[model samples]
Target: MMISDLPADLLDEILSRVPATSLIRLRSTCKQWYNLFKDQMFAEKHLRNVPKQLRVLTLKENRLFLPSVDLNFVPPSIEFSDELSLNNSNNSEEVHIDSAFHCDGLLLCTTRDELVVWNPCLGETMWIKHSEGSKRVKERKPMYALGYENNQSCRSYKILMFWDCDELYDGQVDGFKVYDFNSNAWRVVNYPNCFIMNSHGVNLKGNGYWNAYDDNYVDYILSFHFTGERFIRLCLPPPSQGCMYTSLSVVREELSVLRCVKGSSKIEMWVTTNKMDTSASELSWSKSFTMNFGFPVLVYTGLLIDEDKKVVLCNTIVGDHLRGACTIGEEDKYYSEIAFEGMSLSQPPHIFNYVPSLVRIQEGTELDVFGKSPRRRGDDPPTRRGDTAMCDHDFQFSQEIDDMMS
Candidate 1:
């Protein structure tokens, strides 16, 4: 009763359950097992079977370690595709991230206690005015939340920026602000019921992750219908006290969320069919198979794509531990955990643009309402990199670099 002899579907299921490293090692087990695992149909199924989670890559050792074992898509031809260099000229705006979340194929970044949305595809940047809030003027990361809505005529994404305006570290929030991509401006809004925030920023994946105010004092998934210009709350299964991971993700025809337990091997999957209806709150929590085979640490930090194959591409962090977003002792987790000084020693700048989220939508099309600043698209393919100063330009071996370093 070897693995090769099992039914093909069953064998692929078992293979999908294993980690990426273990699956690669299993390729040497047998030719039949190897071929079965390598099949394209099996690849799609394996991606669906694995958890839809996020992968984080730290800037260490001049490389990015890819962790997609369940070959979801034909791996793109890229070699050590992580280390990127700064043009210095292109980086004049600072583009500091107070808080950021990805939605509708773009990044919503907040800074200066204000909000700025960027479309990396079109190379567009827009400064959205922040609505009036706490008068204290304390500086912090602006965690921006984004979501999409569709109508008979068009579709638009909403950017919501949440921050502490009060000068005091007290829990009372001064105010909340909102930005509409369609109007191309920011509007002030009344404050909603405050909820607990995940202190560490490493766990942020999608922008519009929120909960509805409930009797148990927990947040429900907040949903905005763009066409209706309305807000609805998604009733999610309650989170366990010991759980360190929870995120909103979509599975097939249903909207779902993932909750992971710390120091344990399994993550719970909750799929919803109710769509934006609050009447369907049935107080029932469902369970799914274990993903990663250990504590489901990095759920929303990776990339998941469903095309010819269901591939979850994960970028693993090199050093340090995968910290929880909201920890007990530490708060203020705005994702930009590292700081870099720009060729100067004073005024430390918290660098937030490092973790690159590879979002894939329709190949030829993108949204227009998100504001596209027209720029000549460069046709040059990204260049290969090496162990020197980070750059995309071809560098001839020269002693001038040596003298500059000395």
Candidate 2:
């Protein structure tokens, strides 16, 4: 029997097992394959079939890099691969990427003039211009976040933007907006006293969470529900007498807070026991084990936690080099640090958990609204320009398929 004569279910099973890098090339093999890969059901099934692994994506010198490390091995083996580089094309100048956030297999990068959503696996990028009101606002840094929500019938992604206003009215600011992919337009939203301290927000299960301060200068965990399009504040744990720093992160799929005391050498981590319980009074925070780095060092951010091995990945700066530290939870507390070989010390990297899949960015009404044409990699669309100096290394995907698979 011909391959085309095979049952639809059989075809789906075969395709779902393929690697995402190879699947990108196969999408253009024929119209039938293209349609099959683009189907929402196929995307969900493909994600389920792939074995989940811990991977980190970093930005340095206006380029994107994915570094994989095997925590199971002693001292952890580290490998680096270049992903994508932003530079001047024929039509526009090179763009400077301010910050990036990863959600559901897609990367959202912000430039001064616009925001771009890139699906590295599929080599597809979408450019979104800022709203007219945003352009007129005073010069203050803007915060961006990417999130998605799913229902019985369909799933949709949304981007949220809020600007730090120069002037305050009764200790309140008003530069909150959201972009819905389904609508293909930006809409202003009501955000009372919502000012995020982080450059980007962390997305978990259809909501974006941030470490934020309110009009009264009170710190809290701010949450924005994507489906409901509203904001809520969750109370934080009581502060230490001499707390030096505090930040928010995800630990084992739960909201976690990392606190550093003024005269302490160790960082204390707290995980929320009742994450699904949204009520402020009902939310509970439990103190996890402390990570002692021996000497007092800056704990920039918590990357991820390996539940099986009880290792936590974090970013730290040691004198001149940028390093990744692994804190182990064995009998005797120990930690190890590896310098990120080629990254600059100026721009510290932000790390996130990434899973490879064949998920498409635009779906349903979005596809019909945006033109039906396919956007190639080199297409000359309106671009954002940046002033950072370029690196000397050649910009390309340095690692081979074997390196990534291994």
Candidate 3:
């Protein structure tokens, strides 16, 4: 029998094993196949069966880029090979992505005036306009985290938006809001006071994690659980007095952290010893590896680790006007640079992992909680912010970057 002649159950099983990239092209093969891809149950099964390929993604000047890294080389190499198309509709103007957060296969991106959930693999976009109350703090540009519940019955995606108290200006207080996909509305939530170091959070399983400091200035791994709508404080990889910079990333489906010592010129890698779903008290870490760079390295953005190859790739400012990705190898004190041309000196490029999947985005309708309509496609865009100076919340980070150079 031909492949297309197979039974529905057999075909579904076979197709679920195919990689997500290939399924994108096969969606048009038949009406049955197209509808199968839209089924929420099928999407979950496909994600589980398909092997996940984690690759580095960089955003430059509001455009998304995929970097191709080959580890077979003696020192490893990286190049910009592909760009994910963000313009899918009739509008020719490209939206300026002010910030982006990734969870599962969907990207929660924000322009100056609009918030959208985008699936690059499926080329689907869901635009969610801000509520009227959110406009009061529009100038502050609140940080966002996209996550889902860990329930087995069904998955509910949510976007957590909050302004860091330190980022507040003119004596403004912080605000917290959660955008529920089911209700298509934003609801307020109470949270504790903590300074989240990065605007973009590290997503693992169905929760969001960030390197943060409590009111006491003691650093710890801060997590926001979507199911419970609460913040939990977890221990870090032990405290180090020489630790100048600490960043978070996910590697091989596990949470990993990179700690850069100020004067020692050494960086240590740590990974969670057990699954994060366990109790916060039971969470722990084990040192993966360490490398020495002759100069003090600052890794506040993030880093990609190749445990098998013993190499780490991180983004850095090469000179006054150039930004590049430095590849540090085993037993090699020096790093090789792959400088990115035409990079903006004012805004340093941010690096994170992107996993392509078939997650579907449900676009919000015209009606909102307040029964008011949001900005339409033809509406004029909001005024843009002109200044490029780092925000006041990042004052200590700026000082540390300067100390590294001095």
Best by TM-score: 3
Q: Write the per-residue lDDT of candidate 3 for residues 74-131, one digit (tens) a residue.
A: 5566666556546523474677776678887889887766677887666567666674
Assess candidate 3 and give its lDDT.
0.67
Question: Which parts of model 1 are misplaced by more than 4 Å?
Answer: 1-98, 111-116, 127-136, 139-141, 148-151, 164-174, 198-207, 211-219, 224-231, 238-245, 252-254, 274-286, 292-406
* 23-111: candidate 2 lDDT, tens digit per residue: 65555455577678778778877776755533566665556666555765566655546455554223555667767887767778877
Q: Give candidate 2 misplaced runs (Cα > 4 Å).
A: 1-6, 10-31, 45-51, 70-83, 86-95, 131-137, 165-174, 194-199, 215-218, 237-240, 244-247, 275-282, 317-334, 338-347, 363-406
RMSD of each: 14.8, 7.3, 10.5
Worst lDDT window (10 residues) for model 3?
378-387
Model 1: per-residue lDDT, tens digit, 228-255? 4444454567667866434444443244
Pairs of colliding residues, candidate 3: none
Poorly placed runs, candidate 3 (over 4 Å):
88-90, 131-139, 165-173, 278-281, 317-323, 331-334, 340-346, 363-366, 369-406
If scored against the real structure, what TM-score would every candidate get? 0.46, 0.75, 0.82
As a whole number from 0 to 100, the lDDT of residue 164 in candidate 1 is: 44
The prediction achieving the highest lDDT against the true structure is 3
By TM-score, the candidates rank as: 3, 2, 1
